[model samples]
Target: MGSVDLIASLNARGPTSGFTDVPDNDESLPDDFQREKAKLFNPLKVGAFNLRHRIVHAALGRSRSAFATESPLAAEYFRQRTTPGSLVISQATSEIVRTSVLNIRKAAENEGRDQNHIKIIASSTTIVAATDEEAFKKRGEYLSYVD
Candidate 1:
């Protein structure tokens, strides 16, 4: 599906969107994108350091265990996607402002990446665009993706 269709689908089934990215084939995304000629794989700076590609994942409703700890499955799920210079922003249970850090860190280390490269964030705040004009231009597109 196209990007707008995908977002609308997510909004429609937000609460029940259980790890929606699990592919039907259960196969890893091509690890060779950055090696290809596609412009999506071109390196560029996002917020700070340059990324190897333009792809960034915004995950929802993962780390589904109680607020105390993250499941190993969750770590493994993230580890598979943790290529160097890749960016993933995931949210845990909304009530869990923090959770066990070691499992995710260990998973990153096992993937041959520095654990510090991964960042875990939890919030109940609004995210604004770079400018009011930009925000107004795209109003309501990203609101209430999670119930």
Candidate 2:
């Protein structure tokens, strides 16, 4: 092997006290490109999923459900982006059959008034979202498959 390959192999074995890099012209990227480019920023795969690009969308707290109940407005927003080949990392969804109690409580708390009224309503909603065994089981199964 050449000198560069030899260096890489040494690094991989974890005994190397230093590292080296081969220089190349990076200006070959498109003139319109605005972001810095590097090999570490390249795309990677995790089993059956192959990312088309290096960009990753982080999970968001959408405050809604896939079936459109929590906030129909939030559901509509996610639905609009369901087109194929788009990379959208979504927030953790509620277990199927779950409701919007967390969101309702969050909204009331943020508004900062009517503490007693909101607490009662929030408590009731929390009870409604908490009573599902089957849904939680299904959620666990789904996570297991992904891992």
Tens-place lDDT per residue, model 2, 23-136, is 333113345544335333345575566653444434332434454344655545444433333356654434531345555666777898553465422111122234488667
Which residue pairs in model 2 clash with each other?
none
Q: Which ranges in model 2 have alpha carbons more than 4 Å from their true place?
A: 1-42, 61-69, 93-147
Q: lDDT of each structure?
A: 0.58, 0.43
Report the backbone clash tally of model 2: 0
Task: Candidate 1: list runs displaced more than 4 Å.
Answer: 1-37, 60-69, 92-147
lDDT minimum window of 10 residues, candidate 2: 120-129
How would you encode candidate 1's per-residue C-alpha lDDT over 79-134 as one tens digit per residue? Answer: 65555676778765544444456777888899999999989754565647899888
Candidate topping TM-score = 1
* Candidate 2 local Cα displacement, residue 34, angstroms: 7.9
